[model samples]
Target: MTGRFAYGLRVHGLDRVTDLMPAPPGDDLPEVTIRQHTGPRPVPEPLDRWRQVRLLADGRHLAVDRRSGTATFHGPPLTPDLLAHPYLAAPAVVVNRWTGRETFHAGTFVRHGRAFAVLGSRTAGKSSLLAALAARDVPVLADDVAVVHDGGVFAGPRCIDLRQPVPGLALPGRTAREGSRTRVSLPPVATHVPLAGWIFLSWGPGPALARLPAADALGRLAAERSWPQLPSDPAVLLTLAALPAWELTRPREWGALEATCRLVESAAEAAAGQPA
Candidate 1:
């Protein structure tokens, strides 16, 4: 099936059905074709200086051609969850990077028609926080990678991967084991919302929010960027830095999640000029 993903990418040749909808009418988005290889995986070769063939942990072989905008997957049969993630999501980001779009290793949620990107380290509970927000009726745009272009955050796959089930948080749709994490599928919600601000996650004694200076925010964002080895567009980073940012520190306790969610929602609402 063909579907549209973040960064205006029309991905074709997906083996399993996905919640990702087709592009809106008359919208011209870049196309990336996925072709399944049934034979032995080819000897991996670099597509270019920027693209290389990769073998995922699950024995999936991925190869991307930047010039032609195509990704070839070969290996064991893929489940729906795997296809949506490393297969489709990985290439989509690569295509976006090739086209000069900026992507961050962050989660994003929508509040009051604006998006706030939650930036954090790998174990910083970014996905956990997003799952918590999802449970609270907040619209999560993307879980792991938030694509930014022209100051708008693109909607990502309709799912979130969690290390384990969050207590008292139940999401609808398929639930399955994806490696070490549980993949919770969500309903389709494609929205490209204007980014309102950034929220950096940190651990502290209690829940606290502090506004970050532009310089400080810039450094944190840079550290959480996807494909940092590649050159970044200074203009894009500068523009994002200009947005309102805060360091959200909270006690690392599951019991603190409720208060943490409230803080995030309030901050997002406040940024959107809505009464918190």
Candidate 2:
């Protein structure tokens, strides 16, 4: 059975059709194709591109596409058992012919400039921090997983993400036309930045900023990572682990903005090899 999505979504990874296309053997990587369709029927026009976002706790999402005849697993720490696991058999989205395997679990995000990412738990002020950085004209890198490759972070999709700010704070020019979820760009930014420090953030009733030891910051960031089980390249992980990380408690009313600016500036400087 071809596992196509009910929506007329012709974009890659959004529907079940493209999810199931055949791939080269021994390598479990998706040969993605973005095409257009009309109400489950393939459209002659070029397919518009879009992105699919998945938030996994413990890494467990299965996808299958019938039109292309493919199946895949999106949860973290891709394992051999992922092939036969019952949970991996069912997914939030499914296509037919495509099949691939990823040893790592990564959430998707489109790029803006250097692929910057914020790793933190829910309510940890990740989105707010990113918005603040955008306000400072740093460019929205990725609100979630900022996938990093050899030399730069990968931008695979461009989407618009508009969601609510942290509980108490209100974002300027926020619109309710769409749901609470932010609209991310579809065509991802291809620009790659040299590996920069991954910043870790925290908030509290009182305002204070402290530069955490590199080790401590890495540990904290590690805990907040999306997938801890994936067997990733040791060198890449090591480099990320060695890079500096920051932990800043939320600042008081007017102080929050200043603190955010300082933190971003510090990160930029660190990335640029300037004194912080």
- Strongest candidate by lDDT: 1
Candidate 2, residues 1-276, lDDT tens digits: the string is: 121111111223333322122222332232333322222222122211122223334433323344453334443334222221212322312221112111111222222233434556655666556555555555554444444545455332222234554333334432222344543222223333444555555666544445557667555655554334323344555566676555556653545765665656666575556677
Q: In the order shown, what is each candidate's alpha-carbon RMSD? A: 2.5, 11.7
| TM of each candidate vs. truth | 0.89, 0.54
Distance from true location, Cα of 225 in model 2, Å: 3.1
Decoy 2 TM-score against native:
0.54
Identify the leading candidate in terms of TM-score: 1
Residue 111 lDDT (model 2): 28
**lDDT (tens digit, per residue) of candidate 1 on 148-176:** 88779888777888887788886763455
Cα deviation of 141, candidate 2, in Å: 1.5
Tally clashes: model 2. Answer: 45
Worst 10 residues of 2 by lDDT: 96-105
Once model 2 is optimally superposed onto the true structure by TM-score, how far is the C-alpha of residue 46 displaced, in angstroms? Answer: 37
